[model samples]
Target: MNTPFPAIASSSEVRLPTGHHWLYGDLVLPESFSGLVLFAHGSGSGRHSARNRQVAQRLQQRGIATLLFDLLTVEEEHVDLQTREHRFDIPLLTRRMQDATLWAQSQPQLQHARIGYFGASTGSAAALIAAARLGSRISAVVSRGGRPDLAGPVALAAVTAPTLLIVGGADDVVLDLNEQALRVMQCEKELAVVPGATHLFEEPGTLEQVSALAGDWFAAHLSMEHAA
Candidate 1:
């Protein structure tokens, strides 16, 4: 499903202001990108996640843009590293996601682009909550080894964007959780289990599959053929 396209046009380090703090991120824009996907990494991860960067690169080849950002400030991340508190604070994470989306929408190059979210781990819950609140502003969502159940019943029921939940088949507990979340979600959605993969999807070719699936989902939902 990964096809060749023109080279990426830009890759930049960006700082997004949310509340009183600034979050840093890496933004990649392909030539004539069709959509923009904002990434919300799982707990303790940031823009430097190699797995996320791999997925983002695949999307770029499909003419989609990507933003991989830190959900917490340096000070907050430091404290959370010790207390393990902020990573599980879903409300705070959701606010950051929303703020990032708004910030993207205000940008000159991305203002008219369709938007999506690529979330991992606990960040998936934040992405869902933000999508539920933002409604059609979020055109699609993809979760890789995530905790969507943490979004709660109300938020799951309210999500309007089409969602794809990718879980490792070998991760029994998380697969069960994804199934539970799928049952409560009323929108267009699916659960894709990657065989032989664990929670981190570190198995051979597994992450590549995640990239292909996510790229296809975003391409379908965030088409450049129509106005967003």
Candidate 2:
């Protein structure tokens, strides 16, 4: 796991109720926040994902709040670890993302903030679907080495929020998939290819580049000065 970033203005543990389950998460806020970015990690990963947290930290540094939550319950995660059943359930994950956003909107501390999504791997599909369903509620979206094609063409066409799809140049299959999704998407979008990076972006400086790109994208779209 990557070492966590420096302390922020406020950081706390939150529990979001999704009718049948309570998903746990980490919420980090800066002193004077501009917007909130929700994180959706891939299958077999959750709020504790090092890469996601690193990106979240960068957002916080830019005065953007962040929420990194688990998409599955402990029991479901254990079952998925054994059976790989719920990992690919895009609809289920999409509902979870929607529920989490509603939960954030209901909170006194976060209700007034604009919302965005930062998704990695399969979680990108869930984020895109949720963004499409939420319409103008979502201000921006950023995907890192994600399978956005799993979101399907309809959702891609329906997304109105500006999006940035970041892929590792060495990840040929996913890069092509991102290109296809970009073509289907009618919203403002861009595909960023980080040279020499792989699927996980474990290479030195690659993850940092992802963080920088995501921070800039969210800063541009999630600003309070802009309409959501």
Candidate 3:
């Protein structure tokens, strides 16, 4: 039986508030979509990053839509990389994610879809903070080798979305932080450690495991029709 869905590679972009632009990504949508999974890349990686693209492709293949946007404008990225200040601006990035979520909700292609978030590294912190602020607007969240601890106690406690945290077994420091943060999260959450995977999950096959875990988590949580 042929699955009613689009293949990987199709993607686009949209302009957000303040002239910021977002790469509206993923393989194209089938007639109907289960939900939208927006990607929040790590501190150094942007939307076009190969690792993130691979994960997004995997999600898109599973009938999910994904958006990988450059959180900071090019100019901002340059400055942030130079000064390293804006990269840790979790509050600002959270607000931007919130703005992007609202913008996504208004789009014709995604208007009726439940929204989910996929965040990595510091971006995970921003995603959690944004979920806390947006409340029921977001249905699910997944963090890959993330630093959700950076979101702070208030945001961690306030998040209500079902969340999945995928960490590297070999990355001891981040794993500890993720464990500690998990205790603070009042939402439905789980932590999975990929054996032999490092902080980047750059080890062969590790990223695939992360992607599969993320896809399953999002599908189970976001596919449900609920009032938000």
Say which candidate scores most in lDDT: 1
lDDT of prediction 2: 0.94
Structure candidate 3, residue pairs in collision: none
Compared with the true structure, the alpha-carbon lDDT of candidate 1 equals: 0.95
lDDT tens readout by residue for model 2, 36-143: 999999989989998898988888888899999999999999999999999999999999999999999999998989999999999999999999999998999999
Scored by CA lDDT, what does every candidate get? 0.95, 0.94, 0.85
Query: For each candidate, what TM-score against the reference?
Result: 0.97, 0.96, 0.91
lDDT of 1 at 125: 97
Tens-digit lDDT track for model 1 on 89-127?
Answer: 999999999999999999999999999999999999999
Clashing pairs in 1: none
By lDDT, rank the candidates, best first.
Answer: 1, 2, 3
Model 2 residue 5 lDDT score: 48
lDDT of 3 by residue, 82-169 (tens): 8988888888788778888988898887888889999999999999999999999999999999999999988899999999999999
lDDT of 1 at 23: 97
> What C-alpha lDDT, on a 0 to 100 scale, does residue 113 get in candidate 2?
90
| lDDT of the structure predicted as candidate 3 | 0.85
RMSD of every candidate to native, in Å, equals: 1.6, 3.5, 2.6
Q: Candidate 1: misplaced stretches above 4 Å? A: 1-3, 226-228
